[model samples]
Target: MAKLVQFDRLGGPEVLTLRDVEVRAPGAGEVRIRVDAIGLNRAEIMYREGSYFDRPVFPSMLGYEAAGVVEAVGEGVDGLAEGDPVAVVPAFLQSAYGTYGDHVVVPAAAVVPRPAGIGPVPAAAVWMAYITAYGPLVEAGQVRPGDHVLITAASSSVGLAAIQTARHIGAIPIATTRGAAKRQRLLDAGAAHVIVTDDEDLPARVKEITGGAGVRLAFDPVAGPGVEAIAQGIAPGGTLVVYGALDPRPTPLPNAHSYPALTSRTYTLFEITKDPERLRRAVAFVNAGLASGSFTPVVDRTFDLGDIVEAHRYMQAGDQVGKIVVTVTHDAASD
Candidate 1:
């Protein structure tokens, strides 16, 4: 039997229930894995609250990423075998079949061979955080050498990854947080400049850092009163990428009647995973970076699978510096 986290009707984290399920053999082009660790994303919270882009299906799984070992491979599945370590990209079925389970059965194409040096815990933490950051900073934003990049909500896992990715691409990173407590942490995470938005003017600090030219790229997750503020920090013709909605309020765009035009976009990892080739490339890029030590998964906390309710409670507090993970025991290796 496989233990999985699921919910029938959702209101709060308390609605999640852990139940045992039978593990069936994989069908053609599918694979079965003994899950080791699962990555938790803010999207899950929105899904639970009935506010995400996708509506939840009752009795659905609630995880987005996981790392495990292949326990079985179905016919016609190439390049994979039992006992191989792997990381899953759960881009499809964003509303169902999440990673919070003891075992997962997914299409073979969605599985990526994980680096041997990276353990299940850290590997599970990589996909969503890095992909969200990589797509905006490298793919969409096109951050170039010497370009200034501004990141809002700089203390999050995706935000931290954006900072590091920007530095790797030789761009100058300016980060914004709610207060001064996270300033040192952001700096250590490779931010060249940090601003406490409440105390310092975000646009002013960004202009000062960029010699009044403004940043070439702005990545924002918090969208509400500061939407225009984020745009003001970006240079004319710069890209402003919005990926997550941490704030419940609607993000207001600059009134065309008053403000100059800027390229604004809302991006999601779903777009990158729409094609199998793109998904493969993204997974390869992330794994390569992980093996080379250019990318690191910042684990904020890990909860036992049974304590997921507490995990959600802690995540809602909004103090975590990076990814929150759930640890689970595999059926084959019960200790």
Candidate 2:
């Protein structure tokens, strides 16, 4: 048997329960992984709270990303073997193959070979955050040299990824958070400028940062009544790509009288599934960045599988500077 996380009903972090489950062998086209680490994401929290795009069935499994060694490979699987290190991508349905367990079975296609020199914690942390940021900034926005990109929720793993990605492409990344505490952290994380939203006027600061022309793109995850303020900061013909809803309030439409002819768009990583070429490009870009040390996965804290509820609570507290990870132990001898 292996330990796993599950929830019988929708609610908060308290709903998550750790339980022992039987380990089943992988079937056709599936691989069984002995999970070493799991990446905690806000998507899982939303799914647990019944606010995600997909609703959970009763007693549902809930996770998307993990890193581990392959224990076994099913029939017709190729290029993978037992004892190989791999990372599970967020491409599968959570209801079908959740990774918050000591042992998980997922489609072979969803497994990527762990990059060289990266530990299990970083392997679990890289895919979701980087890929989510990559789709909007690199693919859709086509961010170019000298572009000014605004990143909201600058302390999130995805937000940090955007900062690094923009810098990698020779663009100026402006990071925004709710207070001054994360200001220096964002600057150290590769942001050209940091905006404290609670104390600063967003549009005015953005205009000053760009010398009155305004930013070329705004990557926002917190879409609420303040969206119009973000819209006002965009340069004419610039785009605002929103990928999450951290705010509970409804997203208000941009003011019609606003200048700059801004375009508002919604993006999700799911689009990569429909376009294999884009996924290929994104993976190549991220892998290159990882190998060169241009992109680093920042893990704020790690918890044992037994402390998952506490991990969730910490994630919900909104104080973490980066990703939160949960390490799994299959045997008492392992740390």
Candidate 3:
């Protein structure tokens, strides 16, 4: 039997329950992994609250990313075998292949070999953040040297990924947080400028930072009344990519109506998974970045599997500076 995290109803972290489940052999084209570490994401929180894009069924299994070792490979799967270390990408349906468990069955195609010297914790932290940022900022936006990129919710994993990606591409990364607490941390993480949204006006500071031309791109996860301020900081004809809705309120388009020429789009990793060529490119780009040390996964804290509820509570508090991960212990050897 393997332990899994599941919830019966839509609600807060308190709704989550850990239960022992039967472990089964993988079906064709699937692999059974002995999970070592699981990455926590805000999307899971939204999913738990019943506000995310995908609706959850009753007794829903909720997780997207994890790092583990292959204990068994299903028939028709190639190039993977028992005892191989791998990271499960966020390319599977959460309802069918959730990773918040001691063992998980996932599509073999969604599994990527873990790089040498990277531990399970860091491997679990890489895929979602880096790939999410790479899709819009580098692949679609065509970010270049001298471009100014604005990143909101700058202390989150994806925000930090955007900051690193912008700097790696020679663009100036401007990070924004809710208050002064994470300003220096953002700077130290390679943000060229930091904006404390509660203290400084986002549009004003962005304009000042960009010498009145405003930012070329704005990567926002928090979409609410504050979206107007984010849109106001975009350069004429620049793009504003809203990815996650951390705020519960509806996003207003006041600036979009006023600045008709500006490009405003919603971004989701599901789109990347749909395009084979794009997914190939994104995977290659992130792999190179990780191997070259240009991209680093920042883990704010780690919790044991028993502390799942506390981990979710900490994530809800919104004070973490990077990724939150849950470590799972198993008898099998981890490569």
Best TM-score among the predictions, by candidate number: 2
> Taking the tens digit of each residue's C-alpha lDDT, what string does model 2 give over 140-169?
889899999999998999999999899888
Winner on lDDT (1 vs 2) = 2
Against the true structure, candidate 2 has what lDDT? 0.90
lDDT tens digits by residue: candidate 3, 1-335: 88899999999999999998889899999999999999999999988999878888878899999999999999999999999999988887776779999988998888888988899999999989998999889988998899999999999999999999998899999999988989999999999999998899889999999999988999999888787888888899899898988777988865546653678888998777557678778888888888889999999999999899999999999999999999997654522
Task: Please provide TM-scores, in order, for all candidate models, with all chains considered together.
Answer: 0.95, 0.96, 0.96
lDDT computed for candidate 1: 0.84
lDDT of 3 at 223: 81
What is the TM-score ranking, best to worst? 2, 3, 1
Question: Which stretch of 10 consecutive residues in model 2 shows the poorest summed lDDT?
Answer: 270-279
> Can you write out model 1's per-residue Cα lDDT over 1-335, one digit (the tens) per residue?
78888888868889988898888899998888888898888888888888887888887877778899999999999999999999887566756457788887887877888887898889888888888887888767778999998989988989988888887788888888998999998998889999999899888888888989988888988777678888887787788888878777878876655445678889888877767776776777777777777888899999999999899988888899989988886454551
Greater TM-score among 1 and 2 belongs to 2
